[model samples]
Target: MFGRPTDIDCDLWRTDGALLIENAISSDELAGLREAFSRCAEQAKPDWLSGVRAGTRPAAFFDLPDPMGLDDRFLEIVDHPSFYGHLMAFSEGQVIFLSPQFRTVPAAPLSYVGWHYDVHRESTPLHMIGADLSG
Candidate 1:
């Protein structure tokens, strides 16, 4: 399956240039993906570094770059058929990996970036575009 994504026949690509396939990730693969995400944030394990020293859910980081590089499981998610298969289709066999990888955790919260724009006029709307690559 890694060789290349087999071409799709629908002519939607001729006009819309996009296609959405629900249930893309197989349940089995999804289980593995969940495992990978759970392991991705190894730092979640408390090491008494934060000021709280010993609190619930310590040192969990999010929006991390290249999290797939942290472990093979994460990397495997990147290689999973569910993710790359559709990517290959959308890219027409010439995908440009602009944003290779990133991840976010629930506890990080939105406030970090929530008031960022309003605080300074110099700030502008920021959007990060990338493939989930989470098989």
Candidate 2:
């Protein structure tokens, strides 16, 4: 009964193009995932960093490469059968994970995409579909 995302979760996503499910991942898993991310951050090359900011102190934040090879413990959340099954129920198996990565963004006012769409204005015509997940 607790395995699948609820109807409310699905409806919220459909309506607002977003959904928040609390405690979906266990605390231990979360800790391990965080540790894995910390390791990734430590190893991330300077060239891998990217953001939109004017000064030396970025208004945005440090970013990692796409699809971080975080431990399978971390990646299992995305590849899990039960989780995928729930997603399929809502999306009719049409969901696409464009870029699944653990990019660490410090908690700054401008660190997020906010209300604006994630793509360039001109590129909107192409109708690129994506899910912008955060942790």
**Poorest 10 consecutive residues of model 2 by lDDT?**
50-59
- Candidate 1 residues lying further than 4 Å off, grouped into runs, are 2-18, 44-61, 83-85, 105-135
Per-residue lDDT, model 1, residue 5, is 34
- Window of ten residues with lowest summed lDDT in model 1: 108-117
TM-score of each: 0.48, 0.58
Candidate 2 residue pairs in backbone clash = none
**After superposition, which runs of candidate 2 have C-alpha atoms over 4 Å from their true positions?**
1-17, 45-59, 112-135
Model 1: per-residue lDDT, tens digit, 2-61?
433335624555566555656766787768777666665456433324433545322343
| lDDT (C-alpha) at residue 51 in model 1 | 30
How does model 1 fare in lDDT?
Answer: 0.53
Q: Can you list the residue pairs that collide in candidate 1?
A: none
